[model samples]
Target: MPHVEKAVKDWQQQFAGLKTSAANLMQIAFPPLEIMQSPTGCCETRLHWQDQDSEASGYVCIDDFVQATLQFENVPHSVAGQALDEVFGLGWFNGAELGVRQAGEGVYYWTDETNAAEWEVSVLPGGLANLSIEYTNAPDIATLLDALHTAYEDPHEDDAAT
Candidate 1:
């Protein structure tokens, strides 16, 4: 797909501007099975996870728009396997320690020791050619510190009881 290639090239250009090298940009081949059917068309893309100067930071580039949904046509078991393989191949999550959970209908969560991120991929309920991704940034160091203080504080005053 030309669009898919263009998307990958665009990402590479952006990365180059940041003085970063995207060592790996693999193409996810279409699945052999049909799990969900998309009347229009379906395409797959790849993402990379890199360490930013020893900090735990990463970016996920969806071939389509950041707010696009993921759909399959007559999605089969093989497709699901391929999809999981593609996601994990990016090394977005650590091999063993990372947690991947499905929080809701089309929503998934990825969390490691230092960071957490959520992804929602699904087809538009009806037959619409659109997708979406809603991402919420994990709490920063300051936010976590404030939460720790609140956790240790007592909710009641002992003087009143005395």
Candidate 2:
């Protein structure tokens, strides 16, 4: 079996409680997982999401989008294949107006006229998956982090008795 446990633990800190856009993306991308924070303030999760891609037909797609990056953990190879199908199916037959291309065995690229993103998947020995997402020409992730910090500030701090 692969070193799925330790591998996920390594990244789990960074994957723990997210804020702003990061939290939003986490909610959308991994609806089944719980976003928690470690004592050290890093993100963590234990749920493994199976890959899912379907020819979704709706007006809910993005428009003039600048950028987006989505990451996941413990995904299976079979799920990866399913995601590949979803991306290609939308690109080729659904008039989704996006570009999809395979970069290598476990790498895929999705892009449009003004935005670009990549999905890289690495499978551990036990068939566990580690996925990394990167995006260009989109909102900075730091912005999301900042939003989280800002939300935690006390509203009455400035008004405290002098």
**Against the true structure, what is every candidate's RMSD?**
18.9, 19.1
TM-score against native, each model: 0.22, 0.35
Model number with the top lDDT: 2
Q: What is the lDDT of residue 83 in candidate 1?
A: 39
* Model 2: per-residue Cα lDDT at residue 2: 62
Tens-digit per-residue lDDT, 1-162, candidate 1:
999999999987785543212112111121111222223233232232232232222222332322222222222212222333334433343331222111112333334333233332232222111112223221221122232223223222231111
Error of 1 at 33 (Å): 19
Q: What TM-score does model 1 achieve against the real structure?
A: 0.22
Candidate 1: how large is its RMSD?
18.9
**Model 2, runs deviating above 4 Å:** 1-25, 38-68, 90-113, 122-129, 136-162
